[model samples]
Target chain A: MTEGVALLTVFVLAVFVGFEVVSKVSSTLHTPLMSGANAIHGVILVGAVIVAGTADEAGVLVVALIAVVLATLNLVGGFVVTDRMLEMFGARRPEAAAKDGAE
Target chain B: MIAVWAQVCYVVAAVCFILALKGLSSPKTARRGNLVGAFGALLAVVVTFIAYDIDNLGWILLAVAFGAVGGAMGARRVAMTAMPQLVALFNGVGGGAAALVALLELSEPARAGITRPAGFGDDGWFAYSPLAESGGHTESEILRMVDLLSTGTLTATAFTVLIGAVSFSGSTVTFLKLQELMTGRPITFPGGPIVFGAVLVAAVGLGLWAVATGSVTLAIILALVGLLAGVLLVLPVGGADVPIVISLLNAFTGLAVAAGGYVLENALLLVAGTLVGASGTILTRAMAHAMGRSVSSILFGAFKGGSTAGGGEASDRPVRSAGPDDVAIMLAYARKVIVVPGYGLAVAQAQHTIRELVDLLEKRGVEVGYAIHPVAGRMPGHMNVLLAEANIPYEQLLEMDTANGQLRTADVALVVGANDVVNPAARTSPGSPIYGMPILDADHAGAIVFLKRSMRPGFAGIENELLFDPKTTLLFGDAKASLTALVSALKSL
Candidate 1:
């Protein structure tokens, strides 16, 4: 198969997989789910790295490095914040609850 | 060529992302799902470094380090109430990164063997005689040109640059609106739609022209115009609908990334980006449904002079104002009380205080439940997050439908810094901006007591008729202070 058609095949199937995975998510998880999806797109860091690493000029290198920084922020901040939010749901012991309320 | 092992690993990481989204469907496994996704990201990055001969290794590592520290710090320090804005900021930066990467691709095709297209000016903005620069080519050389400048790749590049720019700027506007750095109300000028339309058409023209001729200047111009279009697309949306816009922009970024993946011809980027694009679209639609709004209405409703902004002027109509002791007595005597929390409660950081009040009420033999509107707080289910942080048990929080059912027999509906969600107009007045939004049914309770800071309208900017109802009493103060006062007053009783 040609390269373009192969990529298109992956794209089409991924769209279906995406829809099926989150289709039944309850409204309560919408916020975290959106946040998680936000982090997933940070995979663009791979493209940024490729561009930066292959850059033949100083200016291009600088711009690509900036992209790297921004992608890192998106990927790292997104997952940490989501984990913190979800942590609230998981740790509901008596001691944890008292500590949270005391603050 | 990248090794076969790397391609297989990319497939594995893609599955991890799919499982991540799947696990988020239920609260029971959400955190683990996020961790799993993080692991996938780490694996993908490691594989890329190992498989490719990347240059500027030291600089890239330093940049990654700086970004990691900044991201973790921001995530750690932000209060739970401010999470929507933080998410907007993170989404914005991701989009900005994608746009930058696409712009770089115009001058520097990243793959080892691919050559940069000819006729790039020194400043990287202009191109002169792109076709003439490649003259005197052999048959195989011409064929190589055809492969490098394929219509599909150029179209993907155009899509990436435009949509990525739009997502970046749009998310920034949402962040500003949510952070109250800009006006929460829709800001519109006369002939706003015409101006927006003109820019949008120009952007599309530039995109097509760039795709056909592979002009670097035209591509840069498209990016600039896309930024303006993004700002215009979001400036007219009111505060309550901003979260939905953020979701849509998140989806926009996802599609942009997917196109970026196509441009780069990397399977990993393609799969992950499309997954996010599809899921973010579905989530945005679901949120709009929860608010009883259509996606188009939420976006362009302001352009048609629809109900976008409400009059912010406080009404002079008399409300039966009461003191803390009176509210305490009302709560003390009630058999069952329902608490309707809103954004104001979060602004005052009153979740813990309200939790204390609920605990005291329960101790006094009053059954309590929190009525959570689907669109309450800043985003969908944001109130639940704030209350969960305050250690409120999951069972005490009731969704809109269930809470509405129980409000019928509840003795009192104590609305703490909440207005529009309990307003009677959503059910009664067709002209109201929030008319069709399903509310908490606070009007169905036996007695209604509101703890408000002022007589001003709610976030959507419409005054609530329930505040003036004969059966309603208002205790005016900050949510935290009022709840604390009520706690002391109930103790004295």
Candidate 2:
């Protein structure tokens, strides 16, 4: 239970740190940023791993295996999609042919 | 010694995740930030494998293999327009995983006949340590295991399961709407608000019951009730409002992950999950604000589309319609043009064709730029991704406030399949649902050319007051075909 107190402290600090980190993301990149954040929550895949591989009963293992599969999908899909979207923003804008040409 | 190594790896992973988000604040470092997060994810999995005790590895390995293949295939196959839908589905998957992990943790003991301690899971509630020893006879160990089941842990299990259930089903509804497999129109029932209110209360009651009784059955029932509540949450939000709903549900998945971390007593999970939860919440509020609404209003407003006969009002409104040649002449001679992209553009799959038109206009010495509303398309930043895929420069994509200010000076504002953001009703007509929402000042352009399938109201189901302005000329037909025709017309001249 002493570890629970430590976990609580870590959780509380993360709440503030996390918000501060992403508060200034440009509106254009919001979707990819969100998808990136989605991948981060896949950290729970670790819990799924332990439960699926070593739980005493077949039922628990089966359910945990499903959880494992889902977490993997979310984790991998989230990062890949985010990377693909961000890749579009990196194309160097066709030699910067028009710099506020509309003005 | 191995414990120390695993803890160190976990710490590094947490830092990488923090850095990943911090870098995502700008486009310059976003990709690198993502790779860093991936590295962290891979490292976390490796470290866990080292630390986790396993009697069997075949099932876990198979699951990982299955996910990797499915994820890669989906990412490559999905069109840019469907990215939001894919993201929604991923959020649902993560939420489902969290809920299942909590449920399996609770159910394991009943099957194994562990009566006193309740959860004799793989590593038990506490991380297996050297102090645990071979003999499980210590009074303190017994008390600690009992405490894990009896009080605080049971509450966390209930919270995680319910939040996870809501995120899973709520995200699925958002996905369906984005995919157009279900109607994007708000599907509110009679007394919709009151119905949702009752469901919310019932869900809360169920959550408390699960905690009070520590009954797995109650928790499962509570999860089902939560699933119903999720569907109710997103069903009433119209297409224009679905972006915010997706963001809100993304936040819900984050909160559920954090709750799951508590149940597992894992600090890395605690940090990563809380960070995601906080980020999603902040983004959700920002999205809601951009719509000139509160989070609660967006969730419960039902959008309640105006019943004032859409056909009757549109019939009385006088609009000058034009052919491709007339639109081509207007666009060709304009000094500057602002192309406003919307959900319609995505639906028509006209992003590339519109980019071609912009290029033609550019070659003809007409300056071209895009006016991007914050809440454009199906999700936030949707237009930017679509245009970028067509290799449009990031510089030409102007924010709504900036573009609106420049609209007066621009000669032509070519609106392709967009309606709500350009609607003047947002600035006038207090009775309008989108009255206070910010809109692109397309009407201020010297001439306005609108591309549309028909005179249909935008997803908000509100009439575009801009369409009635004398400077606007409505061009009827598919967005891509109209633009392609306009390109040919310009080439002929």
Task: TM-score each candidate.
Answer: 0.94, 0.92
lDDT of all predictions, in order shown?
0.86, 0.81
Give the per-residue lDDT of model 1 (tens digit) for B444-475: 99999999999988888888899999989999
After superposition, the stretches of candidate 2 with alpha carbons farther than 4 Å from their true spots are A92-103, B114-147, B305-317
lDDT of 2 by residue, B1-493 (tens): 1387788899999999999988877889999999999999999988888886655687798998899789878987898888988999999999999999888766643343333333324235344322334243355534433444655677778888998999999999999998889987778779877988899899888877666655678788988998998998889887677878888888888888888878777777778889999998998887777778888877766466563336223456678999999999999999999998887888777777787788898999998889999878877788888877777777899998889877879999999989888888878888877878888989889999999888877777777767888888989999888888998998897
Winner by TM-score: 1
Query: What are the chain A TM-scores of the candidates, in order?
Result: 0.90, 0.84
Docking band of candidate 1: high
What's the residue-level lDDT of A46 in candidate 1?
86
Model number with the top lDDT: 1
Going through the candidates in order, their DockQ values are: 0.84, 0.51
